[model samples]
Target: AYPILAKHNIKPDYVLALERHDLVYQCFEQDNQEFDKDILFIIASVAHKSVIDTLEKTKKSYILVHRPLPFSKALHMDDYGYLGSGLSVANMAYDLAIKLGHKNIILIGQDLAYDENGNSHPKEYLHTQESENDRKEGLFITAYGGNGKVETNQWWILFKESLEYSIDTNSVTTYNATEGGARIEGSIEKPFKELCENLLRENKPLFEKPQTLSEKEIQDKKDKIDECLKRVVILGRSYINECEILKSDLARCLENLNFENQDFNPLSQRIYQMKAKFEDEEFKNYFLDLIRSIFFHFEYKIAQNYTKNPTNIEEEYAKRKEYIEIHINWIDFIIPHIKLQIQSIEKGLS
Candidate 1:
């Protein structure tokens, strides 16, 4: 989009990015290489390190921003640019628009549906290149004019829903000027040309580019990030040790195989102890996404409340063993995963 805008001699003042993965870097590497270097790229601070390195190497104008959760809770907004919203960079752009005091928001190219070629994103994005596969797995939604259905994947469906929620909650009015594609429920679907004819006149510098932060501001943010990452490392190590203790306690209880007998109190107490350890407000706030991701992979069926009306002691014992083993396996997995996370964050600090 930046390169295309540049091609037409229209460079947007800013290009916001919310992706924390390397794909954002891959996008710049694959295509869009001719992007306007002057366009400020407001990136999430948690974004892959390679992205920051690549932007620096290419001399692209960029700045890192906090992603709301940990930063909004722990750090001052003045430390880093506040980049909220998780769904899409476009939504973050909305926050920026509001900050700029724009009461009217005009959205363009928010198709939220596949193009004629069946691609959800630009052709240059390799991640969405397999349009046929996407079409096979995707669902259809009502199109803009309500006369047809447009094919869209789950992710775009989510983005559309998020935008509708934002529009409903925000004080500003949203004009969806895309002219086609999946309908945004709360936006006024006016044609771009029609809106331009009515609302736009030959403008005489309606807005000014926001000022860049001074060296002292950037240095302050760096110091804050360094402090937080060190604390995360300490918390992560403690969490890993706690999980190991729980696993060991569970193992001892499982050796006897009966929830009603032998070492039961010890195992239950260990699990209860973990609840308090993890419930630390600072740790939970800092690693909410990490906790959510781990839980998402939890095997809920097996760990479900005990077998209903077990026929005998043996049957109940077997069920209890299965449950304990599942938890131990989960602990075994996360201990190493947490270590890796610590290592990764540590590298970034370095």
Candidate 2:
């Protein structure tokens, strides 16, 4: 949208982004579009560092906002308002529209479903080749007009659910102008041309520059940020140490274990203790979300391929060992990313 609209001298007043994935930075590289300085980028504070890096390299102006979804516990930017819902960028845009004092909104191109050709996303924001493959499994679901179905997927269903929830709660009138695709509840269905005829105006409306913090407030925020950054840095290092402890305990138990008598109670208790570390209060405050996601990914794989009846106790032991190793590897995977988050925070504030 940025590249095509810019070519015709059409520009958006604001753009919203809430993705935390590291790969999201690549979207800016597509088409090599020089984003306009006049455009305000409403970036989530928890977004990947690479994303903010690209924004800076392009010299685009932006304001960092935070979502209250575990964000209040992780970072301190509460003054910008919690502007995320439904865990989708569309929801974030809706929230921003309401925050900016808009009482009416018209949705368009909000398909939330694959086209008849099986493409699940626009070319502008395709995250990866793997995602493209994941989106095309030849699926279908009920369409907008309720007379037929359209090709869709699990994610598209989820996106619609989020938007519907947002609309159901907000005190505003919504006109759904998407000519085709999934149905969003709580929205008044209308044709795009009909809605435009009633809503479109000949003159443009002026927008006020949003108020920002004063100099004293800015200094206070910086001081608070510096303090929080140092604390998170110190706390994040403990995860590595905890992983080492888990690895050592598992190694000692595995070496002397006896699988001869079909007795695995001792090992089971050890595994229970190993899982407890991941549930600690302090750790959950920072890295538990990442840890749990990786853990579940491994668990899901194990369950997907599990046999109803294993040949022997050795196979069960193997599964147990695999489970423990997943936790160890998950910790290893998240620590560096934690540092990357801190770097992102520093750069975002700078």
Best of the candidates, TM-score: 1
Instruction: State how far residue 303 of model 2 sits from its true place (Å).
Output: 8.7
Per residue, candidate 1 scores C-alpha lDDT tens digits across 1-350 of 55445556776878777888776775444233455545678887778878887777767777788777753556556544576674888788887887777778889988888777776666644565454344445589999978789888788888888888888888998999988888999899898999888777666344455687799987988798689778888988989888987887788777756588555656756666775666678767656556656755654644464534568988776766776787787787678877887898899788
lDDT of each candidate versus the true structure: 0.73, 0.68
TM-score of 1: 0.85
lDDT per residue (tens digit) for residues 154-272 in model 2 = 77778888888878888998888997888778888899899878887656577778787799988988788678766665666565555566666656555665443334455446546
RMSD versus native structure for model 1: 3.3
lDDT of 1: 0.73
When summed lDDT is taken over every stretch of 10 residues in candidate 2, the lowest stretch is 124-133
- Backbone clashes under 3 angstroms, per model: 0, 0
Pairs with steric clashes in candidate 1: none
